[model samples]
Target: MARYPTITEIAQKLGISHSTVSRALNDHPRISSETKQRVQDLAQQLGYQVNSSAHAFNKGESKTIGVIVPDLSIHFFAKVVRGIQTVLDQHGYCTLLFDTSEKMESEANAVSKCIAHRVDGVLAAISMETTSFEHFLKLSKHEVPLVFYDRVANFIPVPKVISNDYQAAFDATMHLINSGCTQIAHITASINLNNSNNRLYGYLDALKSAGMEIDEELIHYYHLQPDSIDTFIENLLTSHPHLDGIFVFNDYAANYTVNVLQKLGKRVPNDVSVMGFSDEPVATHMTPRLSTMKQAGDKMGHLAAQKILAIIQKQEPMEDEKIVINPELILRESTR
Candidate 1:
């Protein structure tokens, strides 16, 4: 590989010392304007670019932000990444992304790698099984500011950005009740997840508020597998017999459920009403559009980025601000 010219080479070409070249490139006020302009013009002509790696090595700040998500395949995480990039780009900062795919150890290892890279900060959505927070402290001790988003650590002192899960679930359940769904069932992800637990509570709360019995049989914990979901739903149908409504944890699962229900010779909304969360691409593109909760993934990502920046700049974050942006109920063909 061809080696690029160094600052010393550029200085030699411009008939100046390396220190003068450094000051000129960095726009130091002590350097005369004419000298700085002359050096800059020469450096540009030589195709000079500062070696950021070397600069970071000396300064100990990479000017890079590391972002970790559960999985990039999920539409919601992808939307959040786009929003994070938008904000990071505006501030001349670069983003480094890591996908944990819901693995607890992967989440910890990703954070360790980010710290090793000397990143200025980190933005992470804690993994589904992340219970030990020792890995996070490694970053904190280095003074690398971290902002948790979507799924986060309740015990971590870092500021977090998340959708209003309780209210969103409450409103989604209420919608089912308003549709006259007396036997509503919920298909949700890991029961240990705060959002998942909150959604379950919301469903039960809605039932109580509507003067209905909270049946334990109506709750189903979903494990991702074609056969598992099929059997679960089949058992649900066979056991409940009167189930009229279903709330899925996410659009991908909802899409799969729709397919499964069709195989069982049931029509959506007409035979059974359904609702999903995250409003993924499939939600709108499906034949019978899904009624779901809309989380502002992009907005949440942008806020997470901004919060990390504020913390890095030593600006006092709204200390008491635990931002919970409300989720919208997107009404469509899936519900009446």
Candidate 2:
């Protein structure tokens, strides 16, 4: 492969020392303006690009941020990534992405690889099964700032950019209740996740406030694969025939559940109402447009990127300033 023009090569071509070339490229005061301009113009002509890898070898960081997400197939993560890239690009920083495939081991290994690459910092959304945080300490030990978004490991003392989950869930459940849904059921993800736990509490709290009984049978929690989701939802509806409303973990699952309910002869918003979290594209595109809690994925992504930059630039650890973007409920055809 052809190599990019180097500083030494530029200096040799211009009959100057490499140090002079470096000074000129950096716009150092010692280098005359004429000399700097001449060298820069020549460098541009040669298609010269700064070697971030070489810089990291000599001065620690590669000026690149590592972003880890559970999976890229999900559109929400892709939207977040677009937002991160927008902010990172403005600051002349590059992003390195790693998809953990929602596995705990894969997440740990991804962090290790990022550390090995000498990234300036890390922004992550932890895996579903991740519990042990010892793997993330490598960045802290090396003084590379780490920031989390969406699904976070709160035990780690890092600032996070997250949606206002509790309030969103509360409002969503209350919406269902106000819509006259008396038998509401919740399909949850792993209870270990803070957001999942908060959503559960929110659902129960709404029930308490509505003068309703918090039935344990009304809530189902699991970490099933995509293929099994339909079966699970089918079983859920079959067992709980009285459930008039369902609040799902995400929009994809909610969509699947709606399809399953339709197969079982249950009409959405008539026989049953459905609400989902993270209002992705499917919400608007689905047969009965979904009612959902709109998490600002793009905003969360931008904030996570900015958080890492602030922490690394300041040479400080995570602080109390956890930025929380409030989620909005989008009422649609899925709910009456």
Candidate 3:
């Protein structure tokens, strides 16, 4: 087997000191451009690569950031990761990604691993089961900079990048009301999530603004069970036969709700209009394309990455602050 090339080998071939090769490879300002180029040329020719672990040990900096997401299968989170990579890659930092599968236990374990690895910083979107943030607090005790995005711990004193879920939900609900929907139901996610709670408030306020009665029965708090949606729709239809609209918190749930509505012989838009949030890909692929609020997942991720980087670089201090991105309402066949 061919052994991997080392910095010492590159230095020997270039007739330069290993220190010179190291500085040149790192693009240190003290290294002259001519020598740096020669060192780089020989290193590339020899298939030499920097041993990041060793370099991190020597410098006491990992140059790696930990990114924690509830679920990687979600398109919105996937886009957020892409946006994070776009920034981190340009700054010579790699990411250690953790998919917590929307479970609090997994999220806690991921945090432990990040701390064990001594990551330079962390960006996280809390899982649905994350009602308490004690696990996240461990990172702070270790002095690791953290930034939350999308799903967040509201009480945590750290930077958060989030969409204006309240405004988006309000606007989406108002759109349904303006389209002649007198009796509208709502489907929201786990009550533990701040975004979901904000969306619920927005939905409620929109109904109140329209002089409509707030019926507690008309609102369904979804708990990630598809079968529950079926039961909820069946009961909703029986209780309120004239239900004309639905505003859901996320696009996937909205798509599922639409399917359930169709199975119950209700025609979308004609009988009931449906609006979803996040504008995920599933929204467009449905039979009647879903009308939704476009939450900029990529932008949110970018902003979160920038915030963590700033804190890590000492350019800004980590504090309790929020950077909000307003969502855009996209009209489609799902709504009138």
Candidate 4:
């Protein structure tokens, strides 16, 4: 492995004072631009990793941000991270990733670590189990700008970048209704999540508008798993007994629904109709291609980066906007 050079070693090699090399490494305004460029070029050649811990302690700028996500294996969160990386990489910022795996304690610990590291900002997709906002509030006390993307805490007053969940669900439900699906059923996440509530509201709104009675029993809410969900699906079809259309709140859940439907000898769109949110890559390739609400995950992630960066820079007073990106409803074999 090639040895990395420290500032002191670089200064000795270039026959310059350590202070001069330090100033040049930081591109201090006092240093001549030509000298700064020369130092940077040589540092790049020598593969110098600026000791961010030491530099941030001295200058108070970490030049990095922390991202806390509920789960990285999900396509939606992964795409959100990709979007965040695109923006951060362009702005010369690095990211520290923390996966909470939907655990409340893990999310809390991740927030503290981000604060201890003195990240310039934080972009978080809060875990589903997070009910208290105190963990996030700690970041504010330390003056760390925070932005929420996708799943978020409703009580927190921060710039949020999210898809129009309510509207997206409404649109998906409306699409199913238009496709002659009258007896519709909804499979949603636990109601504690703001996103889940929004989706549920949308589904209800569409059903009400169509003059269909909201059958409380037709709505299924549970933690996601394979075997557990299979039981839910069986109960859903057996108890209600009249479900022609089904709206799953997320793509992953919808995929599982299709799997269960197949095992139960139900043909998608022919025997029943289905729709899901967040047009994950697999939605298109399902046996009966899934109709889904397409959220702009990349757009939300990039916008979160921009807003957090702006907050860190203390840019001119602008309205704290709740950016709700509209979703697209894609029709496919599942909802034909």
Candidate 5:
């Protein structure tokens, strides 16, 4: 195995004390300019890299942030991670990314790893199966600052960066109503999730505001099952043949819903209009492209990163706070 060149090796080669070499490498004010140049030149020639762990140990900080996401495959989450990296990189901090794959057990293990790594801070989005928040609360005991984005625990007294899911869903449903869509259906995620629950409430409220009948059968609580979507749509069309509009919580599911609708001999925006959320890449890739609400994933990520950094730096206190990003409506061929 190739051994990494260290400052001791550099000092031995330059015939100087290791302390002088270290001071020169760090550009200490007491170090002379000539010594600094020679040390830097020799270090570069020898391919010597700074030991970040030792540097962090001396400073009593990790200089690293842990980011935990339920699913990295989702485009929105990937964009959020990119946004976080952009901010963290600017501040000379590195990221440790963890994907929980929507499993509570994986999320718990990721939290343990973050604590073991002694990260300066953490940013997380709870998984679908995360009903208990004990794992997240453990971070507080270790004095590790934590911030949440998107899927968050409402009871946790920490900063949260989130989209205005309720307003977005309400507006989407109201748009369908304005476009002459009566008897609209809604597809949402698990009830345990705060965002999905808010969206479901928004959909219901829109129908009530428009004086349309609120049919329980029209609302489907999707649980990450593709075949369930088909069953719901098939049963829905059979029970309510006049269904005209469908609002889904996500673009990927909306795309699947559209495919199912087509398979059932329904024409999008003609026989049935569809609206989706998050404006993911799948929205445009699907035939007859989807009309959706655009959640600012990158902006949310930036806010979460900033909040955690502030907390870590003691510029702000870690308390119960919410920073909300309002979503924009993106109209396309999927809806009238």
Candidate 6:
């Protein structure tokens, strides 16, 4: 194995005292310019390198950031990861990423891993099943900063970045109404998730504002799973013949609705217009394409990264700070 030169070896090679070499390497104000230059020159000549671990140990920082999200395959999370890496990598910090698979247990374990790794900071998006946030307090008690983004925990008073879901959903509902859709139906999920709950409210408020009576049958709220979702879609479609518009919780469900409609001999837009949230990649691939709300995942991810970085550097206060991004509606073939 090749031997690497150390500070002591550089001192010996330069015929200087170890303390002088150390002071020169650290660029102490008391050290003369000539001595510092000589120490650097000798270090370069002897292939001597400073120990990063020792340097960080003296500064009481790990220089590593931990990131936790519910799922990575959901293109939205993937975009956010890119934004995080862009900023953290540029600052010479390492990123430790964890996926929760949308399970609260997995998210809790990820938090423990971050604490064990002694990360300087953390950026997280809580899982849909996450209601108890006691695990997050561990990072706070340890003095490691944590920032939440997108799917956040409102009970925790920490820095966060999220989009305006209520307004976005309202806009989507208004668009469906303007497109000549009456007797609309909304498909939603777990009320624990702010995004899901706000979306449901947005739809109801839009209908109420338009003098449409609130019908309990028009709203579908349940724990969504792929295998069982198809069966539910069929029942909703068959039972609600008057529903001319269907606003789905996400892009995946919207696509499923389109497929089920086609199989039931229903024409999209002509028979039933559809609106989906998040504008996922597959939205444009369907026969009539899909119209959706653009959630600006990249922007959300970038802001989260910036917030955590600010806390880590003490450039901004870490308490109760939040940044909200607005979402836009995208007109496409699925909606008239």
lDDT of 3 at 231: 92
lDDT of 1 by residue, 1-336 (tens): 988878899888878899999999999999999999998888888888888768876876777999999889998999999999999999878998999988889999999899888888999987767778899879878878888888877777778888888888889989999988989988888755767777788888888889989778778787455566688779888998888899888889888888888889888988889899999999999968999999999999889888888887788652425667899999999988
Segments of candidate 5 deviating more than 4 angstroms: 13-16, 27-41
Report per-prediction Cα RMSD to one decimal.
2.6, 2.7, 3.4, 3.5, 1.8, 3.5
Considering only N, C-alpha and C atoms within 3 Å, which residue pairs clash in candidate 5? none
Relative to the true structure, candidate 1 has a C-alpha RMSD (angstroms) of 2.6
lDDT for position 230 in model 2: 66
Summarize candidate 2's per-residue lDDT along 149-263 as a digit string, tens digits: 9888887888888888888999999999999999898988887688888899999999999999988877777674655666666766778778899998889889988988898
Residue 107 displacement (Å), model 1: 1.2
Say which candidate scores most in lDDT: 5
TM-score for candidate 1:
0.90
What are the TM-scores, per candidate, against the unseen true structure? 0.90, 0.89, 0.90, 0.88, 0.95, 0.86
Evaluate model 2: give its lDDT: 0.88
lDDT of 3: 0.93
Clashing pairs in 4: none
- Give the top-scoring candidate (TM-score): 5
Instruction: Estimate, for each residue in 1-336, the C-alpha lDDT of model 5 and write its tens digit.
Output: 989999999999989999999999989999999999999999999999999878996899999999999999999999999999989999889999999999999999999999999999999999988889999999999999999999999999999999999999999999999999998999998987999999999999999999999889999988888789999999999999999999998999999999999999999989999999999999999999999999998898889989999999999999999999999999999998
C-alpha lDDT of candidate 4 relative to the true structure: 0.86
Ranking by TM-score: 5, 1, 3, 2, 4, 6
Candidate 5 vs. truth: CA RMSD? 1.8
lDDT, residue 322, model 3: 94
Tell me the lDDT of model 3 at 5: 93
What tens-digit string does per-residue lDDT give for candidate 4 at 40-147?
888999889888667666877888899999999988888889999999999878999999999889999999999888898899987878888799989878878888
Worst 10 residues of 4 by lDDT: 312-321
Per-residue lDDT tens digits for candidate 6, residues 168-221, read 888899899988998888888677787888888899889888888888877776
